[model samples]
Target: MENEIAIHNEIDLQSKIYTIRGMKVMLDFDLAEIYGYSVKAFNQQVKNNIEKFDEDFRFQLSSYEVLELSRSKILTSIQVKGVKGGRAYLPYAFTEQGIYMLMTVLKGDLATRQSKILIRLFKGMKDFIIEREHLISYDEVAKLAIQTSQNTKDIAVIDQKVSALATIIEDFTSPEMKKDFLFLNGRSVEADIAYQEIYSQAKETIFVIDNYIGLKTLVLLKSVPENVKITIFSDNLKKGLHQKEFDDFLKEYPNVTVSLKRTNGIFHDRYIQLFGISEQFTALIVSNSVQLEILLNL
Candidate 1:
């Protein structure tokens, strides 16, 4: 029976786990399978009791994460629902604690038996990591990522190969973006990814020019590394971003220093500049006149 349980752990349990947002998690589809429910039904149940799941317990993957996970066989499987013909919503992922909360909400003999097995498995995994914590450090993980992907483009492969530790490094740190040119039109998510990736590279300061800047702009700037000074010039703060909204954002992300100023009709365009180490710089031109025809010039 011990041998049988070990086999079950390796196949039914560990194989379903994936590293996401610095935590090991199971996708909604996989959890639905184990709990004997349709993906739609399972998600609906969780939504009904959403108060039980916090950001750490459950969270939706970002658009870029969806793109990255699509490379995985489990995600690419045709059986996965809510991901076809321009997906209505991204899938939700559940952490170990989330699974614990979920078992309380779900009923049935299968759920009861499976929850016991899962708790045992979760305990084992936690104990193993605790015992080996001294063997792992943030610096060591960073060095591993640097060594494995000297060519940063292969960084996605790290997500596939060394998912657990790779996810920790990727989450705590940003990846190198090698795009020399990115054109954006009718693509909100891709544009957001580009904005975040470029901003994450800034070591000291950022310059921005957008006539219609708003709270959403600050949301994008949330990706800028801590302590990076940001200066923005906008023609329509009254109509777009208000002082209150700006203050709230600053309070929430106190580490991100930002200043907003009016363009005063000096410029009629949108662009961004990133200043990094040794005074190196990069530029992005996003035209509001064309409804965001963006160009990031590296």
Candidate 2:
């Protein structure tokens, strides 16, 4: 009877797993309930053992993310109550590692049993995803090769799928090169790092497309090799002081050749395309507010 109950609990737990911030995670409230603790107490214990959980293991959902999750129905009950009501706190989300680390801090027999079950479930889910990817990769690559020999339209579709699969494979194999989607509200550290990475890899040219270009955006390009060619396609050529700032930057970096063009057509989005030797290129599609960045290798 006890074994059956545990099996049932594990099955229920699987349904609670959610993909947030491109990671599989569980909300603090749900985990607390499964571990037989009140939400307040469970979160308190996590706070006390904060060192056990790093940014990758646990993260508090942002307001934008909270709204997004609620709209998607992944977080069915998410809402903001009055500030005085103590229900206004943003929820903490725990990844697989965070869930496992909880076992070290949480006490009681129920916690122990649930932790063991959860660890197994998390591992099983990871294994399943990896196995499925491997199976799909073999089938997809064969189809893609055959499609390439056929026509341009079919080749384009195959190329897109192959690029996506490559990203997935890189994320699984080369964890260090795994792409990160970063929020770009302010001076984003991740954005700076990404810029540095792209600049470091560039051997020939850097192409940029943004409707509006400002000094802040140009700051990210300063570290590019002095010999590399830079091209900017923008809707607005007159950015007042920012244009002057870019002029000064060009004067300072004499070896860098930058050409700014007023885009002939309406282009609403931003992209940073880096071209390297032998036709190798990588691209970053950035949001207008600099609020989002998606990195892709081609």
Candidate 3:
């Protein structure tokens, strides 16, 4: 009977875990209940030990995210703690590391038991994934080649599904030149496309920090979302970019707004900061500056 009860608890815990920002996480409400505390009191304990929970560990949900999660049935519709009419403060989501950190602050039998179960659950998942990745290899590639030669009916759909699954596995395990994009000589067009793709991910703002900027940078800014604001910081060395260039850029892409500010020799290297609606990503700079053909895959 104890074993059956344990199985039921595991199922219940599994339902509370959800994937957000490509990481498995649990919402504050669910975690609070698991740890035997009210959501209000739970958050208070976190606040008391706020230093432990960094951005990777825990992050608050944006209003848009709340609606999105609710629509997908990942989260239930709920109002802010004290607000009456509209949603004010969205709940915080804790990553695996953050959930582990919560136990240190929350005491008692419930916290201890839940922490042990969570450790076991995460360990099992890691082992399962690590073991399965070995299977998406020689057999799958041979099958793909065979299917292509035979002119299969669902070739397009099948290929897409296979590629998507491979990409997910690669994102976690393979160091396919991880996080570093090495552009070669005569690949200016490809470099520009890569930069545009990274810029397009920003929902709110994109801050480009380069000590030596030029007219060429304005061309890259054109791909950013019309609603997102852009700020470029460059030193005096950026004399290559004339006021006329920016004027021409704005005239052509009036919807894309970009602001330029001089750093006056403060920054040493180039960096791109992509700020999402609810989260902020910082310091994604190619090593040894950008003109040297180094950029982020992120």
- What lDDT, from 0 to 1, does candidate 2 have? 0.72
> How many residue pairs clash per model?
0, 0, 0
Q: What is the C-alpha lDDT of each candidate?
A: 0.73, 0.72, 0.74
Whole-structure CA lDDT of model 1? 0.73
Instruction: List ranges where model 1 is wrong by over 4 Å.
Output: 1-10, 73-87, 137-298
Residues 135-215, candidate 3, lDDT per residue (tens digit)? 777768999898887777578779989998676445434454443443433232245667776678789888999866777
The number of the candidate with the highest lDDT is: 3
- Cα RMSD (angstroms) for every candidate in the order listed: 29.1, 28.2, 27.7
Per-candidate TM-scores read 0.42, 0.42, 0.42
Q: Which residue pairs overlap in candidate 1's backbone?
A: none
Give the candidates in order of lDDT, highest first: 3, 1, 2
Encode model 2's per-residue lDDT on 230-284: one tens digit a residue. 8888866455326678789878867768888878767767777778765566455
Angstrom error at residue 16, model 3:
0.8
Q: Which of 1 and 2 is the better model by lDDT?
A: 1
Model 3, C-alpha of 153: deviation from truth (Å): 8.8
